[model samples]
Target chain A: MRGAGNRYVFWAVALAAALAAPLALTNNYQLGVAHQALIFALLATGYNLLLGFTGLVSFGHIALFAIGAYASAILVVTFGAPFLVGVGAAAIIAGLVGVVIAMPALRIKGHYLTLLTLALGEVIRLLIRSMESLTHGSQGFSGIPRPEIFGMSFRAGVPLYYLLLFALVLGVAFVWRIEATRYGRAFKAVRDSEIGAEVCGVRTDHVKVLAFGVSAVFAGVAGSLYAHTMRFISPEFFSLGLTITLLAMVLIGGRGTVIGPIVGAILLISLPEWLRFVKDYYLILFGLAIWLCAIALPDGLAGAAARLLQARNSVRGRASLRT
Target chain B: MVELLSVRDVGKTFGGLKALDGVSFGLAKGEVLGLVGPNGSGKSTMINVLSGVYRPDGGDVRLDGRSLVGAKPSAIAAAGLSRTFQNLQIFGGLSVRENVLVGRDCRLRSGMLGGVFGLGGSLREEREAKSLAADLLEKVGLARFVDAPPSMLSYGQRRLLEVARALAADPKVLMLDEPCAGQSQAEADALAVLIRALAKTGIAVIVIEHNMRFVMNLVDRIVALNFGRKIAEGTPEAIRGDEAVIEAYLGRRGHAERR
Candidate 1:
């Protein structure tokens, strides 16, 4: 917490491991799963900006993600827009919607905001299902191509996985660098106490809107990535259950830290595959894990790990002082 | 003397309970005013109104001749008024320095995009805010605890931390609500010295204290309130002997204990 050099080394090692992941994946299916993990990692990292830093419990987040996916699919499949343009448009569209969602936040507080967001999310999903001409209704949107940037095709799983990894890396770096900035501090202050932040000259209304907008942009990009990689997206996939999973990824992994959601995303995404032996009951195990984590690691795995690391460092420092 | 803050006939009602009824006062630059009142006499409500925590149902609050009646607490802070709560509201998730940096957030011109890119302008601004945080913490004698969390600080030390954070906004007017509450005598004396030094720098301060000894010695003027009305306003000596003030205190069960 005191700006240790070890923190940088820790992240550097994590980055190196991420770079080498596809090499160890061995098969296209495994690499495809890695791609999903990276996309969700990006999504959860953005969600952390709101849930972990801003202290907003908005259930409408996945609705933004759904919008991003559908927007990209429509632009690419129907209108013949380039993949990059689709992604950019998706982010902008979702970000605008996010700001609209944040408007209700200015007048509401606590459980009221949460309930309003829940209602709003459900409405968006219902709308997506009803809009048959654009979204293909509940039947789903399919056949979206993988990214083709600057004439370089990423049709292969290995190449697509690297593309996704690149995005997640960029996102994690942004969150990391932003933490030292004044806006980042403002975000945390609002989380701690809205009135306190307001009293200290922080324009909390702008901060909330910013948090929502920025995080929604992330959701949009991740949704675009998810649509392209999976080559399919349906209104059903963007349900309240998906929102709960996203929340679990941030909460059980660590809410506030940059590395927390990535860890959570990777763990949650792969845990089901790893628990194939349990078959259908894997969900029960997953539920129990989340419940136990809520009770045992209130700060999440990253927070607990940071505490352990800090304690060890202090212990060593004291030992060295005696010598 | 030019009044930095003027509260004129301000009133607030909570479910037919008139918390502040026509309360009026003016604070001059560099003067420390003590707001003394028995419980439920609207002391907190007065602070809340001036700081924009509540909208006055009647009357107006002006800072530097600008109407601030319906402005948000954040806007009021940007207009050069900052405050600390009676109950500590420090950010537990942030380091001591970051907590103070948040106070200067309005003045910093960095956006989320600038922050994400580690852009040169925002980086420079971030460094400037860091040093500002450091300077404020050192001024409040919390330099050693800059990187530590506020949760680690003692209750008295946390009070000083809050003061440092409030000052980080560089406000021309400050409101401290029960700053000496739960503090030891030595800690309270240290705070008194800090407050006097702050007032000397031309910042008008409103100190709401029930500690008669601290209030009598520290403030340039005293305003006594009873039943949401200003019963007395004058020098500390005058208010100490004012018949209405004596009765206002005597009627309360904690009068002898406070005095």
Candidate 2:
């Protein structure tokens, strides 16, 4: 197992590199894509708490994302709330909804739970489309005011980038801290064997609900950031396709590892843009690539990297023993 | 010693078939009792009912005189009962030490927010839990495999890991379901020694097994069951001489020959 100190150093270096990205990439469009990738990373990391650690597969995460966006948007636009209040409300609302979904989901699992979440995502999307008075329906919510932090407007460009980057770092660190606790062990235990977890004194239902709620909080925060960054929102933005992409990010990056989802988000987000040369066929190629990765690396990219690292460490230990 | 766990007229049924029929037993503190029976004789079902996996159809299960009839498995576990499954229930993905850490979760006082934030108290508790897990692993002779996953351990080692995990709970009543089913004779002997040592620590033990020799040699007393009914109960020596137990195990001819 990786020590706490090593994990801290790894995150610190990664955060520093993220902070320095703007200096090298001066293009506004690239920065925008980078910011979106970071948001997706936050979403993926949160989703992994359920999918990877807790062994839950939710197809309704996009519903949580939509709920977060709509809740924050409604709070700021309709209620004229402060930006920070909107951000906090977004997370709280999504987490509450997560608990509601978890009540039924926890009672049933596997394919049944997946179908339930799928229906939930569709229901949320349809609800948003039908509520034209609040969400402006298909016309979408526009002119969402830029967030202000102590008189500094984060409307676009580097300031907005840094604001999102900070949130992502905090989100990652929060999850990392959770992984080091007894509660974290409970989540893993439940994932491995519900009966074993129960006999070991873990309340499996509570653990599952907490996993869903925490995962939704991450998506909510990401959604809030997305709303402010785009200065617009639409029901179309939170589609079942978006949920599938997030699932792909977690699976390809390697589930159950702290760095896996982030790695997955970055690669999946950038892969499409890099393949733009192929134009219309790029999506098909992307799908094929994901398929290949799934088949070739059953443990995902992170698991492969972990195995390689272990191999290298053992070799070094053997060489030292020879001396 | 006072009774630590009590089962009175407990019964369980699946559809039309009775799995356990009005079974009654009391386990005193520091006592080691063996539950032996043929296949489908309700030994495992009794463990399940007592552990709260199954609610007894008719009767009561109590820990220290408090009824645990309708409680959940986790609640029963919190009430100071820990059990191992007949087929290994080890977490295959987690390290051996991590598995023991999970067992200590019930006794830990930190809440979800505190754990997520890594508050000073929570961090200290985690550190203490890790050390305790290490100690338990050492007791079970699995200290060298602390960092290894369950998949890496041999079958016998995994069995010991399960016992170590249950012991980590510091339970008042420990239940072992067929713990020596597939073990080598040597491994089974080691496990016997460990179980006896655990009982000496003042914890009541219930060993459910089909291995007659192993159970007979390890337990102070024995309870025999056949077709969901108790056939006999007595000291290990008395159980060996009991005509009903002989009939239950061997056949009607074995009882006739004794007569």
Across residues B1-259, which tens digit of lDDT does each residue of candidate 2 receive?
Answer: 5778888998999999999999998899999999988788999999999888888899998899999999989888889999998888988778999999888888899988888777759889888989999999998889999887888888878888888888888899999998887789998988899889989999899999877889889998888988898889989999998878877778898656757
Q: For candidate 1, what is the DockQ-based docking class?
A: high
Misplaced by over 4 Å in model 1 are A1-3, A317-323, B252-259
Per-residue accuracy of model 1 over A1-323 as CA lDDT, tens digit each: 44567778887899899998888999888888899899999999999999999999999999999999999999999999999999999999999999999999989988999999999999999999999999999999988998889789999998898899999988888888778788888899999999999988888999999999999999999999999999999999999999999999999999999989999999999998899999999989989989999899998999899888879989999999999
The per-model DockQ list reads 0.81, 0.80
Task: Give the range of the ten consecutive residues with the poorest summed lDDT in model 1 chain A.
Answer: A1-10
For every model shown, what is its TM-score relative to the native structure?
0.97, 0.96
What residue runs in model 2 are displaced by over 4 Å at the alpha carbon? A1-9, A315-323, B255-259
Q: Model 1: how many Å of interface RMSD?
A: 0.9
